[model samples]
Target: MDPHPPPPPQPPNNPVFPPQTPNGPTIALRPQMRPTSTLRPQTFAGSATLGMCRMKEWWLQVGLLGVPLLAVYLHIPPPQLSPALRSWKSSGSFFTYKDLNIFYRDSSGAVGSSDIVVLLHGFPTSSYDWSKIWEGLTQRFHRVIALDFLGFGFSDKPRPHGYSIFEQATIVEGLLRHLGLRHQRINLLSHDYGDTVAQELLHRYEHNKTGSILINSLCLSNGGIFPETHYPRSIQKLLKDGGLLSPIILRLMNFFFFSGGLGAVFGPYTQPSQAEYWDMWTAVQNNDGNLVMDSILQYINQRKKHRERWVGALMSTSVPLHLIYGPLDPVNPHPEFLQFYKKVLPMSTVSVLDDHISHYPQLEDPTGFLNAYLNFINSF
Candidate 1:
């Protein structure tokens, strides 16, 4: 017998069958045939329809949750103005700029000095930024003035309006004319967004533009005057070009987001206090100011577009010029910003504060900022 043997033959109708054992029952094999069922075969059309239905259901669920959340976010009331902010608002008055009401603070400071200093604040913030140095400034200058530019603190935040540096410069001019100071030589102290406004004003003054304010001297601190070296934060970039997302982001903005973002620009040791952050947030919440930020951020683009007019004003003007910089500023960081600033604006005096100081130097290092400004003023 062969070690391996072939299987026993099966009937023609049954191709396979189990072998019978000595005592076990034999299993039967059935003929192969096509099986029938009630279920229909799936088709590409059916798959596509199923997918579409799932997508529709997903969107429906999202909409069901999203709409109410959006409504709640949009309807959330703006914060109540803090007592300090209220006092600040009460102390200041508004002047009409066209149909819009502009908020400003004017103090008749030291009588001995005839120097008049006008303060232009940064973006997303109001003249309240100058509160830290307000008293110190008053002690040195005869007249001190600061304003919340259109769309800023306590100012009319008109929607669907074109907000630009040129318009802001015009507003400053109108404020001066309104106060009967149009003919007097004045000092300009500006920071961040205000720096660009100051530059435009300087351009107007140098070119003898009609109704331009006379400038005695000009000082800028930590502004994106040079777009090349200016680094806007991630949120800023998004808001500037966010389009639809801008509106959503603006509406969702609150104290936590605002404070976190603002606090990042400050140095580790120089961060703002909780109360300070609350005050800043309150000002932004006023008059729905947060909604206008994207419109206001168009200045970043405006800065790049009109760099020549503004930077040239600094380079060619005969008026005294100075820069008070916080080297740690992320927006306009050290080395790059300072190198470019010094190279381009060599004629302008520079005051570089301690390494730890960052943006908002006036608030971060008020004493150093005030001292630097006063020194520049007294230098000439």
Candidate 2:
């Protein structure tokens, strides 16, 4: 049997999206227009008996196939924002970016402080990933800011919008400008997809395409920066290959698939707790955010498209750069990847964790991660 099942029949002409919030800038959600419905109630009259027999067979097959999926779905509790997230939201602020409300946390109650660090989070998670280290950095730096890109985290997750790394870079720049950091020396910290965005920012900064902002130093964790060396997970490969049917498949199996995928990325020694999994799940499931996994995974493709520019940004940027890697990261692991980084930019400060940490070092080994980060920034 073909792995991809046929798409379900289209709904009758109806508004698919909820009405935009009254106070925010109007979102651009065009109605999903489909040709007229093919199955009218009267059309089935002649074939009622045949249809009924076929429907019975279909239901039997569906029931057998769906029992496990239904059980899995029903077993998982609906997600909720954790107390940490609730506290962060209370202290954080929001601003409109491209008609969507963007969420961010800033330590600088007063602007114009020269010392700054901007944290960019990786995929399938958000600024809340910084929760472990947010307080630690705030004490040492004059300003520390972290924002959820448009599609992820507390930021608005618009279904049809293009979630490109370039656009992500633009949003970060916009945040910098909004906070009056355009002309200031900004320290950068990133992991996973955030590493790609940092590379784009570095490229733009070197070319003078960005505003007056200056990157004094950068510390990027494990990510698919050198696309050639990166290996994506099985779920990622499936969604990329599944085409239009992927989103539908994702919606059906998000909780099961996401939880498993998260488990795989962590080092064997330090897996996430059940509560941590729920917190991450709640972030993605909010506003049907899991539906856009297909759109967001397109960043892997974009990484290949701009590999030369981003990789060259690493190869050539004058800003001091560091790579603090979770050596055992299954998704973007060491040996090959770290070797590639050292091969191209041998002099860039590099640290491989001894604790067998995985992709999310800040969560797995916050002290080690923060020490490496603080040392890197303070060195400059």
Q: Which model scores highest in TM-score? A: 1
Residue ranges of candidate 2 with Cα displaced over 4 Å = 1-78, 109-113, 210-212
The C-alpha RMSD in Å for every predicted model, in order, reads 6.5, 23.1
Per-residue CA lDDT of candidate 2, range 1-380, in tens? 99988866543544664455446864556676445555554467658978899999999999999998887874565476789767877878988887888999998632444688999999989998998988788778888899988888788989787789988998999999998777888889999999999999999889898363578888999889888888999788777667888877876766566888888888787888888888888888776778788889999999888888999999998889899999888777668888888899987998777757988898999899999887887786
Count: clashes, candidate 2: 1
Worst 10 residues of 2 by lDDT: 10-19
The reply for model 1, stretches above 4 Å from the true place, is: 1-66
lDDT of each: 0.92, 0.84
Clashing pairs in 1: none
